[model samples]
Structure formats: structure tokens, C-alpha cells
Target: MEDLKVNDGIVSETLPGSPPAGLESYGFDQKDTKRLLRKMDWHIIPFMSLIYLLCFLDRTNIGNARLDHLEQDLNLHGLQYNDCLAILFPFYIAAEIPSNMMMKRTRPSIWLTFIMFFWSVSMVGQGFVTNYSGLMATRVFLGVFEGGLFPGVNFYISQWYRRDECGLRMAMFFSAATLAGAFGGILARGIAEMSGVGGRAAWSWIFILEGLLSVVVSLGAYWAIYDYPDTATFLSPKERHEVQTRLREDTGHLSTEFDFKYVRQALTDWKIYIHMLICMAGFCPIYSFALFLPTIIKGMGYTANDAQLMSVPPYVCACFFTILASYYADKYRRRGVFLMGFQIIAIVGFALLVSSGNTAVQYTGTVFAAIGIYPQIPLGMAWNSGNIGGSLKRATGIAMQVMGGNCGGIIASYVYISRDGPRFITGHSILIGFVR
Candidate 1:
């Protein structure tokens, strides 16, 4: 037992080890420590939002770029483009566990930033891709870099926030992805309108500009983010203590070293399977429509450019609903009902899109699709993160969920094709059936 002068409210307890050399060197009490920890959220949440937003932007920007001629120019016809999408998934599923393993071993901020830099570099390289093989390689590398980010962030959040607060934080971060969906249209449209700049196509500029922005923001994130409570230097010594104390209230133990055995046990757990199934079902409607949104909107009788413009509204609508649903779910400390309700709404939205003949009616259904489908991400992630007991378990569970949902990417890629373009019966119908 060693005496630690924590906050102004001095308290002495037998610490596990003799206080670090000159442990008494700094002036901090438990109360001050608690305040600093409370302040940490301000530093954390917004940056997480930025990270996911860049990821989403890079991913779906292809949708918009395709509108400007990525597919045709690159000679990606028939299943070739679809195969490129499908390629990313297997690699993503393969890389996720290792990425999370590394995240567990190193500073999450350091690892995440490194991943972002490379993914952005790949995204930038996509602009220069001359043919199918080049594009395929870029997408594969992009998937490898971005694969672990979502799960890594989930693992990082579990390290700091209490279970109760996790839902709202997760929702807010995930909402940025939805926002990217909404805003990407506008961004792509604006960039598309540029048409030609410095001898490059507008679509090329979209990739170049957005990718560079990701690199710069990631550089900033490496500096701004605090990986965990104990290592967070921005907080007062007192706040660091408070942060650790509060997390213990939920986990019963507070340590970053995850037990590998628990990770193995989590892999065999039934709950992981249920989450995987639900996520796979949920993502069918979500990503299927999302990835092909420009095409879907164009089918409604708009020009390619106008269709790109129209894609923004539904995504914006989805973003709003995501936040609302997350806030209410957290408020009541409930998950299942909110999640089911959103799934049903998503199913209804898809039904409307598939069943309707009127252009206005079909366009309206896009709004429903956005609102109904997007919120499931936060709800599902919150459910997994809340229930998992330890760092390794949480990491494995999140990685499993992400990998499982990305399998939906394969299903979605095959579901929506240019041949089925204008009236994608097979695509939206599958989405409706699965989400229902």
C-alpha cells in the first residue's frame, strides 16, 4: 500500500505497486482526476466522427465517380466492376482480425492513423488507374487499410466510455458514415461539375482531393487523439484517475491487455452468431441501395448529374434519423426494439422502392430506405460493445460483426447490376425480403 495524493481531496490507498518514482511529484487528487476524465469526451468523439467520415467518403465516392465515368473509362463492364467490389470483401474479412490484434497491441491512435494514410494513398492512386487490373488492385488495398478501422474504433470506445454512454457515442460516430452518404452526392456533383481541371477529369479530381484530405486529417488525428484513459496526457492527473475509476464500474477490471483466450471463447459464442446474422440482414438494404444510389436515382428519370444531386437528400435524412434513434435507445437503455423498428422501416422503404411506378413515389422511397436502414449500424454495434466483457472479447465481436456485414457487400454487389439498372427488381426485392 502506498499513499497517493490524487485530487485536492487527498486519499491514501495501498496501490498495487510502490508509487512510480516520484509518484508524489505531481499535484492531483481523485476529484481533479475525475474532472479531467470527464473532459476527455470533448477530445474524443468529434475525431472519431472524422475518421469514419473519411472512410465512408472514400468508399462510396466510387458510386459518384462511376456516375462521372469510372466504370466505362476503366472498361469495367458486366461482372468486372462487381468483381472488384467483391474482391475487397474477402480481403477485408481476412485482414480485420489481424488489424484488431495490432490495435490491441499498439496505440490505437497510432495504428488507425497509419491505416488511414495508406488507404488515402490507395484512394489517390485510384484516380490514376488506367485499366481494370489497376482499379482492382487499388480497391483491394483500400479494403485492407480500411477494414480494421470501424472495429478498431469500437474497441477503442469500449476502452473509455461506460456501456451506457457507448450507444450515443457509437451512433454519433456511425452517423458520420451516413452523413458521408448524404453529402457525397453533393461533393461528387460539385466535383463532377468541375468537368476538367489541370488536364484531369472531374472524377479524377474527386478522388485526388478527397484522398489528400484524408491524409491531412489523419495526420492531425494522430496528434489530437488520446488512445486510452491512462495514457491521455491532455487530461489532468486527477481526471485520468477518474476516467479509470468510472470504466471499472462497468468492466469490473480496467486494463488494455486483452486475454487471448476470451477472444477464442468469443469466436465460439452464440451471441456473435446472432449479431452476424442480424447485421448481414440489416446491411442488405442499407449498402445495396447506398452503393448504387446514383443509378437508382437516375432510373427515376433524372440525368446522371441530377441523379447525383438527388442522392444527397435521402442520406441526409438517414443521418438525422440515426442520431434520433441512438439518443432514444440510450435514453431508455434499450436496443432490441429500436433496432427491430428500424429494420421494419427499412424493409418498408425497400418495398416502396421496388413496388412503386411513379418517379416521385420511388424517389420518396429512397428517404425511407435511408431512415430505416442506416440506424441499425449504431444499434447493432452498441448491442455488441455493451455486452462484451473484456478488450479481446469486444475486439473480436466487433471484427466479427464488420466482417460478417461486409459479406453483405458481396451479396449487394451481385444484387444491383447495370443490366437490372433502371428497375432493379432482383436487387431491391432481395433487400426487402432480407430486411423484413
Candidate 2:
């Protein structure tokens, strides 16, 4: 099949391993494109991933802090911990679509850094929470600030990469959060070493020190984050144009302009709601894993420190599998079946978790959780955005779906009550259905 540019109806007889013809007219051959992509990889992927890593860590680090007696310290009883976790989402969901749209109206460099700094402050503030109300107050602010970053970053990256190339990049961003699970464990265990320092508990240190890094990184982001491909200070003019040309090959016209019609179209679209269901399916389980893995691992009868350390491996495994799945999905440009197919792994894992009495067997199930859930959520987001057209509409659609999707986070908070420990059959059984 010939590669056709729809707007001009220019057909290119493309050979294998070459970019669509006329990329050379912009001095963007396959080699130049690959070079430019690596440059983008260096600039965008790691930096955004670092920010996401910290955000994800801050959001769910309570799972680790719980291992250090966060419940006992605050007199948290029964479902208070669960309810506290749930409170963040209402504010988070309320803020996301507005936040996503705001990032578009202003510079992402301006909007996102503001978002990041405030959330980092919330992260730091969690360390000082002496009671339930204090924790809830900080979570309210955390929710309002943290809501913007995920959907905003998803839209930001979509601007820089073509649809077919986005799956792996999206998964890499997902992998950053998984790496945070691994890194969070390492940090949690190390922070445990500082338990009595300055009259603060290890859990307090967990919130303070990890949150401090995000605060620092957020400050530097004002300098580091590029607004758009056209305005990237690090890129040569030819490189920037070449990047734009590649995106244009996928989309005929790039309109960054804000229009109410697109916003209204996104608001009323039934397909966006269907896509929201897909987001819920993937995300409910991913959030379940993130917010409870340490507690879940400890239920397998390992020591608290050992459970903290043990949570690391499954995330490491997930990061590898998640990237591999996205790579092939992007390579083929057929992401539709990947989410549904890989989800079976999670079902099987959960089934093992529910039916098994053995600790090692259940540990294996946790490993499978990441393998399936981690990749599916980001791939789900990529699938949602790739189907939508126009940057404004895509951002709007993404924000809507993400806001709806995080309803799963609220669900996730309540699913694994502390009483369901040891087997946690109810939570595991419920997880089997989330992917389905």
C-alpha cells in the first residue's frame, strides 16, 4: 500500500524501513528521524518519568507507611485508612478535566510546574499529619494539584509523537510509576533506618524526604520542560521542523488553537464514555496494586522490612513486560487487542491469588498483577487519544476519560480492607473482574 498524505493527496511509494517519502524534503530521513527520536527520548521520557515517579510514589506511599504502623500512630481504626484514601479522588476527579484544559490555554511549562510544586508540598505535608483530619486536609490539596499531571502529560507527549509511535512512549511513562513501586520499596526500607531521627517516625520520613525530591525537581522543571516541539529550546530549527513533519505525516493539520466546539464535542461524545469504561477496567486494578501492594505482600507473612523489599521485584518485572508489550503494539500500530489479550494474565494471577493457600503461590500472583495491569492502563490511555483527532479534542477526550477512569482509584481504596488479609480473596476475586 502506498503512503498517502490526505490533505495534499500526495502518494509516496515507500520502501521497507524508510519513513514515508518526502520526509527527506524536510531533511528528515529515517536516520535523522531516529536521531531526533533518541534526542526526544533523552529530553522528554526520563524527565517526565522522574516527575511521574515521584507523584505516584507520593500518592500511594501510604501502602508502605502502613507497614511502619501509620495506622497505629494516628489511631486509624477499621476503614479510616481506606476512607482517607478515597477522599483524594473526589477532588482529583473534579480537578482533572479543568486542569487538562488549563494546561492547554497556558504554557505546560507554567501550568505543570505549578501543579507539581503544590502536589510535592502536599506530599511533604503528609509527614506532619497528626490526625485523620490533618491527613484528609493535605489529601484534598494533593488531589487538586496531582490531578493535572497525568492527563496533562499524556496530552503533552501526544503533541510530540505521532499516533503509531506513541504506544511505547506511553508505556514508558507507565513504567516510571511501576519503577516508583520498586524504588518506593527501597526508599521505604532505607527510611525505616531513620525511624527515631529528630523524633520523627520512619513513615514521617518517608513522606518528607521523598516529597522533598519532587519539590526540588519541580523547581528545576521550570527551566527544563519544553512547551512544544516548535518552541523547544534544545532542538535545532531543522530538528524541530522535522519533528513537526513526522507528526504531520500522521495528522494533516495540527491546530493548537482552543475552540469551544471541540470542547463541547468532547463533553457530549458517547464514545468518550465508552472509552471511559475501558479506562476504568485497566485503572481500577492498577490503582488497587499501587495502593495496597506493600500491605498485601506483608500479608504473605514476611517481616515488614522484607515485605517492603519484596514489593520491588514484581514492579521490576512489570516494567520489562509493559515496555515490551507497548513496543510490539507500536511496531504493528494495532493496539486494540493488546489490552484485552494481556489482561488474561492478570485474571489468571488473581485466580491463583484467590484459590491458593500457599504464600509463594500468592507471591507469584502479585508478580502477575504488574505484568498485566501496568501495561494495560497506559495502553488504554494511548488507545483513547489515538482514536481522537485534533489536539484540543484529544486533550479534552483524554481528560474526560482520565477523570472518569480515576473513579477506579476511589473504588481501589475501599476494595482491599485490612480485614481481608492473608488470602484477601474478596479483593483478589474482585480484581479478576476489573480487567475483564
Candidate 3:
């Protein structure tokens, strides 16, 4: 064996008279590769999914709280409620690129775990805010801490799996948010019933209980989550070597250094902007939907409690469709087609929502919207990550996409204003234009 130095913390060895890049040269056949993938899925996916689940739950449960009279209790008149929701994205956008850089330097486990802890604390703080300004402050800090998670996690996942394998893996991770949407509806229903418990409103309990759950999960993540394949302690040294070699071959190169040159390269890349536009267009509908779904349902003449329960099915349908769409996208290795197809579906759903008057039909439109919007998020992300090469470039690219995309949250917060109640034709029409 000849020792060959490579960047990115990978230790490379060349076997005598063997192909340098082939898995066979490293004593890793198809069977060994399958086992390695299964092992990684076991260790990584569930923990990351759980983290994302809580991250989404903490950020979006405000919608559920809205039904519980959060606005009335906090004295949020006019656009104050929308302002509080809109404020999260600016800080969320500002922190992402920097956060990705920090993740690269500090390592995923430590950096991610640290951010998770602070964001959880921010979530807990939201429960105690007595006024709109106080709630806005908590939202800002919550944005700051949670900003790193999506891009950081996407970059981390790309490092573990090959391009062809990433779609389903990304879907599985992104589905946690959809699952959170479904689970959040049900969880909020139960939590909302706790009104006047310990002299606090049920909405207060939502933040506190969810935040506490995140704290426990964050504590466990330090041990449960693995770092890069090269540095992962759970795998054998031989397995680590196989991981490095396979990924190097797959990506054409690996990025070890956090250099300014890659950042400059990322800035100059037009593909980055194209992907950012795709993300921006997609996220408008998503954030609008997630933050306002319960409100929309309530506007459909359902009671507060029934609105919460009714919100569950759309998210549940979205979860199933996201995974199913990702399966085909990965299997066929055709991301753009799937993305465009889903976006069209979203547009149609919005069209239905805007043009319809029947209560049942409008509700069905939400299911179509959910199915269309949610799947494209992960698919688009995986597509962007798959095309980018090098760690720093990929990191910057992913962060850029997320940063630009989240700007849609600001737009979404305003588009679905309170006055457009019972039938948010204005918001629906605006989102339809966005998707198109």
C-alpha cells in the first residue's frame, strides 16, 4: 500500500497494481457498499430528521398559536402579527452564509448542536413574551440560531451520500418538516386543550413543551450524530477509507480547505443564481402555506379546534408525496423534470383555491398545494447540491440558495394578511404567480 495525501481530512491509500478510484481496488464491492449505506442511514437520518422536525415545529407553531388568540393576548393589532412573522427571515437570511462557514470550520456535530441548543432556548423564550415587541425579539434570536440548520444539514448530507443517492436522503430529511406540520397540528390540538394550566395559555405550553423536547434532543445529538465520513468514530478505519474514496470518485474532487477562492468562485457561478431563483420561487408558497394554513382553514368556517385538526391531512399527504416523488427523482436521476412538474401542480392548486367558492373544494385545493409545494423543496435542494462541487463552494451555494429563498418568507407574511379572510383570493393569486 502506498500512502497518498489528500485534502478534506481524508486518509488515502493506493493498493499496488489496482485501479486508483474504483471501489474494487479498496476491497469494497457492491455488498460492502450497501452495508455501509445502510449503516449511515441508521445512524444519521433519524437524528437529523428529528432535529429538523423540532426546528420546523418551533418556527411554525406560531400559526397554531394564532388560532389560540395569540394576537388578542399579545395586543397585536393591524399588521403586528404579520410583522412578527416577517421579522424571522431577515436574520435567518443574514446568518446562513456565515453559519455555513462556521459549520465548515467548527465541524457539523459541535456547531449544529450548539445552534440547536440556543434555538431551543429561543423557542422557550417565546412562550413568556408579554408583548408584540417581546415576541419580535424572540423571533429574531430564533431566526439567528435556526438559520444554520437547513443549509448546514444539506451540506452535511451531501458529504455522506453520492449525488444519485442524495434525493431520497434529502427527501427523508425534508419530510420531517412536513411530518412536523402534520404532527404539529395534532400536537397543537392536544396542547391547546391545556388552557389555564399553571396559569398560562395553551399556546404558551406549545412553545415550552416543544422547546423542552428540543433541549433533550440537542443534548443527545452531541453523542448520537456523526461528523464527516473521514472523521466518524462509528465506522471502522477501512470503512472510512472506502467512504473517502467513493465520494472523491463521485464528486471528481473533495474540498478540505476553507478558502476565499471558493467563495469567490461561488459568487461568480451563474448556476448559483438560477438555483437561488428556483428556491425563492418555491419557498414563497411553502412559508405562506405553513405559517397560514391553520388560519386559512379557520377562514373556511371551521372552529379553531377543527381548523387545527383539518390542517393535519394536507401535511400528511404532502409527506407521502414528497417521499414518493423523491424516490422517482433519484431512481431516474431527473431532478429538473420533477421540480417543474411539482411546481406546476402547486400553481394549479393555487388557481383552484383562488377560483373556488365551495368549502370542500377549497380544502381539497390545500391538499393539492401541499403535495405540490413540499416535495419540490427537498428535490430542488438536492438538485442544487448535486450540481455543485467542492465543500466550500457547495456550502456557499447551498447557503446562498437558502438565504435567497427565505426572503420569500417576508413576502409570504404580507401577502396573506388578516383582512383577506374567509377567501384569501389575493394571497392565492399572488402565490400562483410566484409558482409560475
Candidate 4:
């Protein structure tokens, strides 16, 4: 046993014969570290990815419903449908900081599971709403419940992995959203065929079934997800100590204490604001594309089923490109170049969509846009999380970034309005401006 000394808020042990610092000093040699990370990937990544997949599907399924007469059933005219989409973000943005604070206090499993359960219930309620007000109410509550998930998961993953190791893991987690877009299209196509089942519309069945899936997954998450390194039950005592020591060496500080000072620090940090702006720029086009891709395809002269099927390829392309970009970004320790490059790709995509009258050319633009935009999300999140030192500061900073970024969803909901129809030049031009 060695003496435990506290330096700059980090508590670490001084082990004799340990290399001065880093994972090697903590007895996590390459083989052991690789094996441990593999275990974590198996245990943690899949579950977290699944949660995000469902979260995105629930949030954006309204887009799919639109193809199946959701607007008609609810009597939504003109901007009313857009209003339903826009209303979600106000409550979503308001709840993030508080929900993240609650996650810190109550533990990730409990806080996340509770939110997942409620958000799913809200999704289910969206199925039954008969009027615009009912739809608005459900959307608001859905936002409130889901507000914490992205940042909470980002912060939670930051605790378990070092900064350099986070990029691909963040990609793996975030690619689920792209996967949801792909899967949502196929699922919606199938569900649209079930229009008369139980006397409910096909669109209604989409919400009900997807929401039910979320509930079951939330229950499983309670048992599957691990907490912080110090409290994780699956690791051996030796492994836990090594893990914590490696992290302490990596960051130089890890404050689990609930302190307002850290909150103030996060709020005051210039990097936090810069990261928030980056997130906003990255997310604006993403939310718009996710919500409108099927419609955009349909406007290109595809039938409803063909449009839904067409939406899948862009998302699939996005999932592939996101992983590749994150891998190299982590390998070279260069995020800024990748971020700028991908954003440029998206700008090109939007330009193509706006300038071209040919349907194939516009559809190709969607693929470019998806691939370009999806990679930046995980890259931005990992970049921001990597810079923040303390656990408390990281939590607050991530929440702030996500909260600000989600405001883009409100902007997106309105950009491609009903009247814009086939070309939507205004929406594409607006997105291009934001990306630039």
C-alpha cells in the first residue's frame, strides 16, 4: 500500500516503481488496457447506443407520421405541424441543466432510466392525441424527459474513458442517431402498411410500438449500465483502482463533489461558449435533415414507400463516415481539421440541393449532407468533453453545449415549411448560412 495524496483536487496513490504518469504507470499495460476496453465496449457501448437510437427515433418519428396522414388526422394546417415540431425544444432546452444536475445527484442509471421511461410514455401519448394542443403537450413533455440524455451520456462516457480514447466511442454512441434515421424509415414503411390494425392509423402504430420498445429497453438499461469508476461493480478491485488512477493522471483533477464553484466556472468558461456555438452550427442542419429527409425525397418524385426507403441510404452513409472520421481524428489528435472539412462537405451538399433541378443530383446531395453533418456531432462532443477537466465542470459544460445546440431543432422545424414543397430553396439556403 502507498500513501494517498490530494493534489489540485485529484486524489492519487504514489506507487513505488510505477512509471511517473499515464496508463503505463497505473499498471494498465497495452494488453490489459486493450482487454479492459474491450470489456467496456461490450458492456457499455451497445446499451448506450441502443438508448440513443430509441431516443432519436421517438423524437423524429413525427416526420415519418407526416407521410402517413398525421397532419390530416390532427387537422394541422400550414405552420401548425411545424409548430408542433418547434414547441419541443423550449421545454427541452429548459430541462437540460437541471436534468444533468439531477443525474449527478441520483446516479446515471436511475436518472437516465427514469427520464427514458417518461419520454417513452410521452411518445406513446403522441399516438393518442386528437387535437393540436394534445400533440403540443406531449411534445413538450417528451422534450423535458429527453433533455438530459445526450449530455448525460456524453458526460458519463467521459468519466469512464480518457480524453484521447473518447472519439470513436462517442462516434459509436452517436452513430446510433444516424442508425435511427435509417431504421426509422424502414420501420415507418412497414408500420404504414398496418393502417387498420386495432382501428388506429399506421402513424399511430409507429409511435405506440416505438415508445413501447423504449420502455422495455429502459428497464434493461437499469441493470446493464455501469456507474463511475469508483463505484462500478463489474470491475475487480485492482482494475477499479487502476482505472481511477489512469483517469486521475489523464485529467489532473476529478471532482465528484457537488460544488457551485465548478458550475460557475463552467458557465464562465470561454471554451464552453465556443463549443456551444460549434454544436449549434453542427446541429441546425442535422435536425432539419433528419426531420425532412423523407419529405425531401418524396418531393423528388418518389412514392411514400420509396421516399422512406430512400431516406435510409443517406443515414447509412452517415454512420459509415462518422466512424471513419472519428477514428482518424482520434488517431492523429486533430479534431479541428476534420470538423472544418466535414462542415465544408455539408455546405457543398446544401449548395447542390439548392442549385440543382435534377432529382438524382438532389438525392446525391442528401447523401453528402448526411455523411458530412453526422460526423461533426460526436467530434464536437468529444472535443468539448476532452477539454473540460473536472467531472462537475464537464457535466455542466456538456449540458450547456447540448442545451444550446438543441435550440437548432426549433430553427430546423420551421426552415422547411409546408408551402416550400419541392425545392425548399429557402430552407437549404438558411442551412448553408448556418454551416458557414
The lDDT values for all models are: 0.79, 0.85, 0.87, 0.87
Tell me the tens digit of each residue's lDDT in model 4 across 19-132: 333435567787798788888788788999999999999999999999999999989897999999999998999888888888888888889989999999999989998989
TM-score against truth, every candidate: 0.90, 0.94, 0.93, 0.94
Worst 10 residues of 2 by lDDT: 6-15
Separate clash counts for every candidate? 9, 0, 0, 0
Where in model 2 is the C-alpha error above 4 Å? 1-27
lDDT of 4: 0.87
Q: Local error of candidate 4 at 33, Å?
A: 0.9
- Mind giving the per-residue lDDT tens digits that candidate 3 earns over 1-436? 3221221111222212223333454468867877998999998999999999999999999999999989988989999999999999999999999999998888888999999999999999999999999999999999999999999999999889877678899999999999998999999999998999999998899989999999989998888879899888889999998988877876666665889899888888787788788898888899999999999999989999999999999999999999999988776666777888998889888888898888988999999999999998888887777767788989998999998789888898898988888799999999999988
lDDT of 2 by residue, 1-436 (tens): 4431211211221122334433544466667778888999889888888899999999999899989988889999988999889999999999888898898899899999999999999999999999989988988899999999899999999999877677789889879989999999999999999999999999999999989999999999988888899999889998888888777656656565798788887888777787788788788888889889988888889999999999999999999999999898776555656777789988978887888889989999999878978888777777677766778888898898888789989999988987888678999889888888
lDDT of 1 by residue, 321-379 (tens): 89899878766667778888998888778788888888988888889888998899888
368 Cα displacement, candidate 3 (Å): 0.4
